[model samples]
Target: MMHGRDDALDALRISDAEAQAVLRELDSVQPALPGGDGRRHRRYAYYVPGGVGLQIQGVSQTYLVRPRNISRGGIAFLHGLYLYKGTPCTLVLKTRGGERLLARGVVQQCRCVRGRIHEVRVRFVEEVDVELFVDTFAQAGDAESGPGYDGGQMLDVLDKLRDAVEDGASLDEVRKSVARLARMVAPRAPAQP
Candidate 1:
């Protein structure tokens, strides 16, 4: 068993040169964004499952990931089983709150730092709808159904919104529906003076 484990480790290891190249590429493409919350809102734990589609040089690939922790800056996946450093991919997260947030990022680093699981770090390369994603997911969690909100339901809502706008439904109607859905999933806090 020990020998098998050693073999697996060796297979997963990346050479130093490869690591450096990956870091260099990431630095060159990473965008300028505030790194999460500097002080008070340091970090937040969120469990959201999503799909990451990679279209690298026309070779398309997709990976399933469950975001373990997310901040304004970036997201960390619990395990990088099939992901590697330097992997450029588009992350599409279907938050529990019925919002689909898209982000362009490259895998900056990944390693099995502790235990046998790997931690994958991605650096954002474009603007992300952090507010909508965060708010929606928070609302979904508070729903009676709990955190296991259906992704299909969210997609259906988006399709309806699109159809409503395309079919010439008034903007006010769309807005009201969106607000109603949000409130149904999660009630908003009272405004401060």
Candidate 2:
């Protein structure tokens, strides 16, 4: 069974007739992608390698998918299954910070890059938990060490530190970042005077 844009709109708690009317109105106008920019929220080069839980409406079970990138308005992921555009779906992201984020969305694009690999784009239907998205760039603390140390590659961390200086990150933020790094890399030394 294929659920289309109508099904997605239906999730908004609107009557079928009203949904049709809205669709008609939308049809009359140049369709701008949700989240603006003629296509969902501003897309960022956020490459967070993590698992995403995907559930297509009418599908009884959930699928584990790998996300390639994310934006405020949507997420793009790679999956083996093909989901038709406009299909209403649920996305559950397990952040590196150990937070689980759930969002309702509709498939916008499903492109087959190679044979069995499908790149799926989903536009969120409602507000998504921002903390989870932010967590993709940072890690949560562990019980042993309180806040966990940086899990990203050292080069990546250095790039961020360089970017902070270039982007005018507050001195306090830089100090904190440096302090965290120092704590992880250095052995017990004399305390700073």
Candidate 3:
């Protein structure tokens, strides 16, 4: 789902085929020696459909980006414009719980892949736990101590709520969204033993 202003994101929006092709290429290209990939940490494919907030240091403008992959040390995202190397940036990644995780980093690489779209890599100043952004099943004593819920579903509902509010939907429509959110947060009944 493209979640930004149509005029702004249309040019940068890439089809699933394009995104997957880039990922496939990365996967097939194995480095001759360990660390030869120039990546300090292993990268995990992050194709989740969402717009990440990109704030360049000393710049007031915040652009939307489509992320491709993530790692403990950094992240790679597709943007419409070419950002200069060494330019500091912060990626605001929204969590399933509607919280934002700020990743501070500097642009390490920005290569044009397709028309008007560039793959930008940013190296974070500090390492981050990959689990924060990626949804994973929680084990016993895990920070997220419960059964995993569908992050996509949550994003969908939140989007609905946002649209309803922004469009000035009637009270009934707002109420319906509230109810849906309530049901999602409500505890489920235990299965019969």
Candidate 4:
């Protein structure tokens, strides 16, 4: 059993050099845009080995993919073959904290980056809380605030908000917490006296 786990870990591991190269490719192709990039949320690099169970042309099959990046809106990955747009797919992603999550989406686009390697983008039916998978709080160079600003506090606020909601906090009480969350995540604005 230990050997099996180790083998799985090894399969998921990507060399630093390869990871860097993938990052470079992603950056060059999808230049970060503040707003009008046609993306509703920011994408974070989240390389991992995942299974994409998809139904294409009435055939259901699962394919192994190399996860490239993820965001609240959707996820992108590298696949070995071409997948038709709008293909119904479900991704099995293992979070940083060793939790497996299933995301259902349809293939939004598929483009070839290199020989026999296709980049497939899937748009989730519902938006996801990216922090659940990637440690966005620990990430550097936040979209709103550049480097040197840590999002640890913001994450704490979010946790509190979720807990309050789950605990059946009153509307007014939740409202106040929501406001705090907005203030923390939103870009800095002029001080309000």
Estimate, for each residue in 74-176, the C-alpha lDDT of model 1 and write its tens digit: 6665343646678876666555576555677778777664443465767677644344455435433433435423353455567768899999999897996
Candidate 4 residue lDDT tens string, 1-193: 0111122322223454664576577768774322346666766667554332332335434455676778878888766678889787677666777776777788999988776667789998887767667655444354445532235446656787899899999999789878756644556443356
Report residue 89 deviation for candidate 2 (angstroms). 0.4
lDDT: which candidate is best? Answer: 3
Residue 77 Cα positional deviation in candidate 1, in Å, after optimal superposition = 0.7
Off by over 4 Å in 2: 1-40, 45-50, 129-131, 135-193
Total backbone collisions for each predicted model: 1, 4, 0, 0
TM per candidate: 0.43, 0.48, 0.56, 0.63
lDDT of 2 by residue, 130-186 (tens): 334654223333344443333433344566678999999999978966765665454
Q: What TM-score number comes out for model 4?
A: 0.63
Tens-digit lDDT track of model 3 for 10-75:
336666577666656654773211233665665555655545778778765677777777766888
Which model, 2 or 4, shows the larger lDDT?
A: 4
**RMSDs, each prediction?**
12.9, 16.5, 12.0, 7.9
Q: How many backbone clashes does candidate 1 have?
A: 1
| Rank list by lDDT | 3, 4, 2, 1
Model 2's TM-score against the true structure? 0.48
Which is the winner by TM-score between candidate 1 and candidate 3?
A: 3
lDDT of each: 0.49, 0.57, 0.66, 0.63
Better of 2 and 3 by lDDT: 3
Residue 42 accuracy (lDDT) in model 1: 23
